[model samples]
Target chain A: MSELATLTLAEAREKLRAGETTARALTEACLAAIEGAAALNAFVRVDPERALAAADAADARRAAGEDGPVLGLPIGIKDVYCTEGLGTQSASRILEDFVPPYESTVTMKLREAGAVALGKCNMDEFAMGSTTEHSVYGATVSPWRRAGDTAPLTAGGSSGGSAAAVAADLCLAALGSDTGGSIRQPAAFTGTVGIKPTYGRCSRWGMVAYASSLDQAGPMTKTVRDAAILLGAIAGHDPKDSTSAPREVPDFEAALKGDMRGRRIGLPKEYGADLPDEIAALWDRGAEMLRDAGAEVVEISLPNTPHALPAYYIIATAEASSNLARYDGVRYGRRASLGQGDGIVDLYEKSRAEGFGREVQRRVMIGAYVLSAGYYDAYYLRAQKIRSLVRADFEAAFGQVDAILTPVTPSAAFPLGEMEGDPVKMYLQDVFSVTLNLAGLPGISVPVGLSGEGLPLGLQLIGRPWGEAELLDTAFALERAAGFGHKPESWWR
Target chain B: MSIDTDTARRIAGLARIRVEEADLPGLAGELSQILGWVEQLQAVDVSGVEPMTSVTPMALPMREDTVTSGDMRDKVMANAPDAREGFFAVPKVVE
Candidate 1:
């Protein structure tokens, strides 16, 4: 790896501002690192020409004495964002080679702030599976491994590639979308910092929809400060997204004071499942650290937490079924060849069957069943009502405490194919991360420590609705207390 | 709540995805297991709660009835699988 690739996003920004480094040099270092680490399968596409052009433009701006948060930084984008003239496939065959004519609002904002796009990272097909194995491009391997163990472990999905790239120092930071732990879970497994802001905090225009109500885009970076910086640049309301909130976007980096005096942190009793000993110990250690930071720690209850997974699955799949109905092989994407005398119905069926993967097909089928006339009340409506209960549980808890803390995942990263055969088991992986989405709350995952086998583990902090500033401040305190600075050796290279 | 082969086939048709006859049995098994797992939601009492259509409680914003941008037929058809004479080409429906 090049020496330039080792700098964090914040560090690189300082160097760029001080005239110690150029954006072209930094971009070239990341491109070299990406080329060397091909075995990790982190990036789906890397457009070096476009990246260099943007970096040169940033260098020109810097020479002209102009500066911004990400003035000369090269960052990776998840394939789910619609970048103009770039293939935004979402790692699915259905949208293969389908370049967009417009840019997503989030990416456009990043560009306007002078951030250069490195390339598109891989993800699960339609962001459906917990493991990125469901992608047409295949699974992304985590950079960390057990001591003396050659087995390739999974970088958790559906933002697995984003996490892997950051962990391996391919980019300063990357964009990741969460719809039931897609960002936090992967960040936890890869020992990176990921933040999923409140649901409507960032505009969703031009982003490929998975579960429209639950899906959200966030930042994945190597440190809490970098996550805060990226979040500041890519947040706010847009007229294009009707659901976006009309609220002022605060300077998130300024809120990372790292002081927790007089704050109230809650430990939800219901989150204590039959966790592994390492995870349980880590959770307790996290609470103790907060208490030592002069914050009052209290035990709270969210009684409806157990039903979040089932309800999340129902609502996500149902919405996914509705959102993905646009691809009919008529307007865009891959089309199945028709036999002689085939009708329109045959065209739709053959095209979808040929385009969608197995997991996607299963989700669509389940969605169709639940939303059908006979079973809508029993399944879909019931799930929505349960969703209300989940949100109510969080609202009730937040009234007593300022923020809630829990484990991001039940355990650390497991080997690839461990839970692939059982879809329900994979769904259970998002148990602790889904309720935040259901409540439209902001949450951040910070790497706290490592498991017994030497894999990374993370603790999740969930804040009240539209309370990201406070949430990031509290997370900064925890990050400073944890003081975790270990990096995995570059074995993938 | 078990999804038999018949129900699976019907669901596939509704979803407009062509499932092979040989894959129906496997698909039925997987769907049945998923439905069985989600049945645990029935144990919760959501009696008085209204079904949440969105996470935020705000109403959808309205827009003025005016054109924001001009037409770009070439840009709209840039990704079409088959386009001819500024229209998407599909199988003829009129006999």
Candidate 2:
């Protein structure tokens, strides 16, 4: 699979700055295409001797010339970040064998931008499901199928193994998170290019919290200039995550130049309601490919986009029942053993009823019955006042639009146990991505085509709150007018 | 607004979680169909709105009171499922 495992993390950082390759040969061709795709379970952990000892210390810091911006490349990360000694399990059987003795400030800014992690991918256990079938290291699949149907499908979820390890190339860009619409619905079910950004643009300390005010972390590439060079190597302002955004990380790959002319965009009209007519003709062919690239699309109105998926499932399960009330097994994770005369509240209810799972115990019992106490103002203060009217419908459509488009998922990848015994039909497949994580903003998605069972279908956009370099320069002019350049043929290799 | 199997065993004992008796009548029919589809947020009228705890309007920052890093009792008892001398053992809360 070594077509240098299909380049593009900005063409393997321009063939490792033209020495024509060798961060241990593009991390041993992405660890031999993540050891032959292992039927797209898409990496849980692969290390390869600490990713070829961080690709031989990024080829000795590119032969002592020391250049960065993802130097030796490789990348994959997202078992919800934390990486130090690795095992970081947000794919949770209550952090099965946890590990992490520190690191994750976006994998220490992708190991100080020399990259090469090549491990920990699978997600949706604590990031909680749209379909990595609420993983404990299980469902990833979607390398896209259909014509001559082989079944598998769903690779969209809490960053479905970083969108099936960057759509099966297994890794050239991965890191995910997006509290809801988990990394732009698995980069629109694996066609790739994800994003999220904006909610304090990046740094959520060590990442794993399901909804600390709607998690952020981004990039799941394949293109849009390798998600603006991995969002300028994992965004800025950290001082250890004081809600990150102290701002100033731009030069997102020098704000891609696909110039959207007189920009505007918008579209909304409550996401053209009950969609499906091939996602309302692919949201009118992504508003006629952003009005044939010169921009000005219009027809806006977020009309509280139908209360952004029940106020993002009540403020992301009331901040995931107060950030999973610190997994009570004591100092770390998985515990539940005592029994014969238990106490400490029956050892915090049998180690959280044997380390949570059924959709994180139905979102920590609907976030402890909407922050209990006579249903705290009738269900988490009316879902935080419908999350302030879904952030005043995207702050009044970013004051008549500078970016908004839509449709990231009204339908596409559905198959693996077809929305398994309905968890609100898998939370209505994140209704067009939980309103930009209930208006924290910046969106992305991209892919833009395919389906009549062929599959891909993306679009999204959104921007404005810290507008990720005008949302990757209008998703690089809708990825150069949806010239999508389809891929998915290796049927999971 | 339906959820009964004794309010799904009192919201799984106020979310400490451990619900059984046949998983509280199938977790009270899936929390009464996710609270009857989040009772469409009681049909909208958020009377004097305000409740958005945070979407990034910042504020909490502070910092300066010194002691920036912790000592790291063995990397905080390396993922302790039991630990002991340096705490985190759990269970016998004053037996």
Candidate 3:
């Protein structure tokens, strides 16, 4: 393996600042890596010229004495985030030409720090499915597979491309949205570290809305520190995003201590109750590792977990239905234009019918029905009430724990097309991660080990709202203890 | 939770998406399965619980009603598919 390919963003930043490496060189290295990993389908679009241009400017800025942690680092942006000049299609054909006039708040901040955009990574259409199979571009496969390994493992969805790109070293780190488990599950599947920060910790102004209530953008990187560095660069209050929390953002790097000598971590019983032996074993081993790091581990229960999946589907699909309504042919997105000289209503009907995919159209119909006349009180309104109960479940757990540990997924990455026909089966992928979104809590997925079939497994860490610093620190400790940061087989020397 | 073809067609109309009558059966089956999944929420008892409108329990920051939007009629219409003299043009609603 190329040792340089495994370098973290922190190391890349230090190297770039010390004059040992130029931003252009780093960007070139990432682009070269992207070229090598192209067969893995890790990128939806790659902007080498733009990336090098930004890098050259960063080099000039540094010569003139300007600074930032991400100065000149190459980053892959998930297509969901609107890049000012880049076509920000959420991996859906509907918004294929819908370029935004303004940059997403997070992407703008990345540029402010002198980070170069490699290009947009692919994702599930509108971030709806757990597998990127829903993407108009096609599914992103795992980079860790070998010959005769026909398991066809998922890289995980929505953020699968970001995870695969990071794992394959196509970019130093990438941005991914976590509407459900988009970020964390893909991270687990691809053997990378991904974080979904507390809702509002990062502004969502230009991110194409999925489940607006649950959507959050965070970093997918090779290590925990990269996640923190990226988090500090992109997180803070934004005037454009009313939902952006106005609280002062903490210096995450300053809090990344190797020692967690006297902290409390909770292990939720509900997260462990129905064990698929292997997954349960992963959790037990994770708790032991945390305990070994001098952290206190206590078993706690979030009793409402059984209801979490149900409540999440209700709240998420409900919000998804509304957020995705903007894609009607009238405004932005592909116009269906059936019946050439038809009236407005006919144009809308035709355009929507042709423009949206099956899953998106289904959600819209469901959302409109649920929010319609008589059913509102029974469905959408009732789901919102249950959403509160779910939030309370996390609030009650956080009172006793500084951070919570659990498995990132119920099972290791299954074969691609395995869950394609079954949406319900695929949704179970978010069972461990969605509750954190419901409570607006920050969470990260760290690779723990490989499954018997040689696929990556991950452990999840949940933190209090705005408590990402402590969360990353604990992950850094366990990351060191776990010693599982091996590169995927495809990248072998 | 099994949506009939008629229910599916009604939903498609409500959502303003056109679907052929023949496609309604497949859509109805899919919608029915999804609704079945959503019905799982009914099992949770949230009788006294309040609906969560936003995270952090913050109220909408209210302000006196004022029209502060920019006067960009022409600029706003620039992206419209069909616009005429600073106005978005659509087929006449009623003749």
Candidate 4:
């Protein structure tokens, strides 16, 4: 194994600061990793020249003794984020060559803090599906899978690329956006730790909007501490985004406490109910682990859990329909030819018909129907009502418990084509999630143990509004209990 | 209500997506199954429940009624299929 490949962001930064390793060496190691994993389809594009140039600048800054946690570290950014001079396609054919003039708030912060941008990672187009299968580019396979498994297992979507790249050690850590379970699900599937911080905790100013109400960006990393360090580099108030929270971002790396002595963790009754037997066993074992680590664990019910899926689909698809309306071919992406004398309406219809994918079209249609004049009362309004009930359920549960524990997905990663024809079944994979999106709460997925088939399972920790520290403590405590230290085989390396 | 092929085609058209006639039957079946899953929501009695937009119960923030936005005209129009004199030029709709 390569020396720089094994170093965490913390270790690599320390070495860079202490003159032990040059930023060029670290960037070169990451570039080699990316080149080695070319067959895995982790990155959409890699500009070696630009990345090295940035690294050289970081080395100069360090020589001047200026320091930041992420300075000189190479990070993979999801293509969904707008990075200047790099294509920000969101893995959709629509924006295949669209490069934004300005950088995303998160990207701006990363650059200012001195993290080298390795390249853009692939994702489900517009952050649509559960598996990365929906990407126009191609599916990103799980690095955790063994050889001869021709049918690659899912690296969870829409941030599956980000998680897979980090798991394969192609980049120190990657930025991922979670609209519903995008980040956490992919993190669980790949055996990496992912945090979807509290809504508005990180600015979504330039992340291509999936569902404006629910989309949040966070870090995917090999360990909890690495994720914290990356989060510290990115989290802060941005004047560009009105929704960006103004709360003080505590030093996330320093906040990692293995001691959970007085914390009360809730075991949501709904998560374990009717789940696959193997997944239930994992959830039970996770609760036991937390209990053994000197934490109080108790059963709590979020009775409105069953209603969360329906409410979320309605709210998310509704917002997505409105947000995606800007994607007519005349703006950005592919366009269908229109007759010279054709009117604006005809132009719009033709452009949209050619630009969007089938799944995106399905969502827009469903959303439009729900928000249409006659059905708004019956569909959209009713969904909003159920949304409040779902939020109230969390409030009630949090009154009794600090953080809720559950399985990230009802099951482990399934094969690529398993849920192809059934979009609803794929959406059901988000059941254990989505409610967090509706409530705009922070959630993290940490690897627990293996299932009966030896696939990895993850325990999800959800916190109250702005409750990331408590969530991380619970995750660290459980990570110790799980002892899931295995890495993916060399095919990925 | 079970959706048929006709309904599926109409919905696809309304959503501005082009679908072949042969694809309608499969879509109708898949969409109907989804509706069946969503129908589970109707069974719960939310007769007096207030619809929720966000998790917190706070009202919308009332900000000063001042106009503020970026002037990235060149950037915003960078991807336009056709542009003329710093504006998006579309085919004339009205005579």
- For candidate 3, the per-residue lDDT at A118 reads 90
Q: Candidate 2 residues A114-140, lDDT tens each?
A: 888888888778888877877877888
| Top model number, lDDT | 1
Tens digits of per-residue lDDT, candidate 4, B1-95, equal: 57898888877766666677887888788667766677777777788887775543444455677777678888888877777788777778579
- Give the least accurate 10-residue stretch of model 4 chain A, judged by summed lDDT: A142-151
Candidate 3 segments exceeding 4 Å error: A1-5, A146-151, A491-493, B62-89
Interface RMSD for each predicted structure: 0.9, 10.5, 1.8, 2.1
TM-score comparison, 1 vs 2, better candidate: 1
Per-residue lDDT of model 3, residues A1-493, tens digit only: 2445557899988887788888888888888887777666778888788888999999999889987899988899999998876777898877767666668999999998899999989888898878787888888877877335755567888898898889988888999999878999999988899999989899999999988888999999988888889999999988677788888989898888868788899998888777799998888888899999999999888988877776777777778777877766655567764555688788778877777777778777888888879888888888888779888888888889889999999988877788866777888888998888888889999999988877889999999888898999999988888999677776422
lDDT of 4: 0.84
| DockQ ranking of the models | 1, 3, 4, 2
Q: Which candidate is the best by DockQ?
A: 1
TM-score of 4: 0.96
How many pairs of residues collide in each model?
0, 0, 1, 3
- C-alpha lDDT (0 to 100) for residue A215 of candidate 1: 89
Least accurate 10 contiguous residues by lDDT in model 4 chain B: B53-62
Off by over 4 Å in 1: none
Evaluated on CA atoms against the true complex, candidate 4 attains a DockQ of: 0.57
lDDT of 1 by residue, A57-123 (tens): 9999999999999998999999999999988999999998799999999999999889989999989
Mind giving the per-residue lDDT tens digits that candidate 2 earns over B1-95? Answer: 77779888888888988877887988899888988888878878989888888787988788899998999898988898999788878766785
lDDT of 4 at A261: 81
